[model samples]
Target: MAYDLAPASVMFADVADVESAEMEIVHWDGGISIVPSGPVITRDADGGELHRLP
Candidate 1:
């Protein structure tokens, strides 16, 4: 997370991008978090799977 940027500013910017991209966001009773679906696999130069991110 970026401590320099205000939380609300980051959130609003991300929300705006999501809106423009037509992405989805989930609102829960506690708060909200949006996880882009599918397996985001990172590969090294050798084409080996290095990590899997959400």
Candidate 2:
């Protein structure tokens, strides 16, 4: 016999939004897993904060 291992659902969003706004993770079976660190904020061409993965 074989078993299936996969998350019930997946989601994504901007780190800033997730931090500044309301965020939720709903899973049917398996639990949710979040990265320890969030996206990094760096200066853009115009010197604005840019959110991106590390």
Candidate 3:
């Protein structure tokens, strides 16, 4: 399962639009990492094939 990462208080002042967001599945050590291209609120788990946002 994946956990949510809260946004840092000190964010960019000149906030721009989000280009895109995606999830990545790492192969090494059988671990999973969620990488976001922009400022998002959620991520996906490693075991699942699809990502479901609430």
> What lDDT would each prediction earn against the true structure?
0.38, 0.39, 0.34
List, residue by residue over 1-54, the lDDT tens digit for candidate 3. 244334431111111244454444333333334454444343233333244332
- Compare candidates 2 and 3 on lDDT and give the better one: 2
Better of 1 and 3 by TM-score: 1
Q: Which candidate is the best by lDDT?
A: 2
TM-score of 2: 0.22
Model 1, which residues run further than 4 Å from truth? 1-38
Write down the lDDT that model 3 would get: 0.34
Per-residue C-alpha lDDT of model 1 across residues 1-54, encoded as one tens digit per residue: 111322333232222233344434565444444444443443434566644545
**Candidate 2 worst ten-residue window by lDDT:** 1-10
Clashing pairs for predicted structure model 2, backbone only: none
Best by TM-score: 1
Error of 2 at 40 (Å): 12
TM-score of each predicted structure versus truth? 0.29, 0.22, 0.23
Model 3, poorest ten-residue lDDT window? 8-17
Model 3, runs deviating above 4 Å? 1-23, 27-30, 43-54
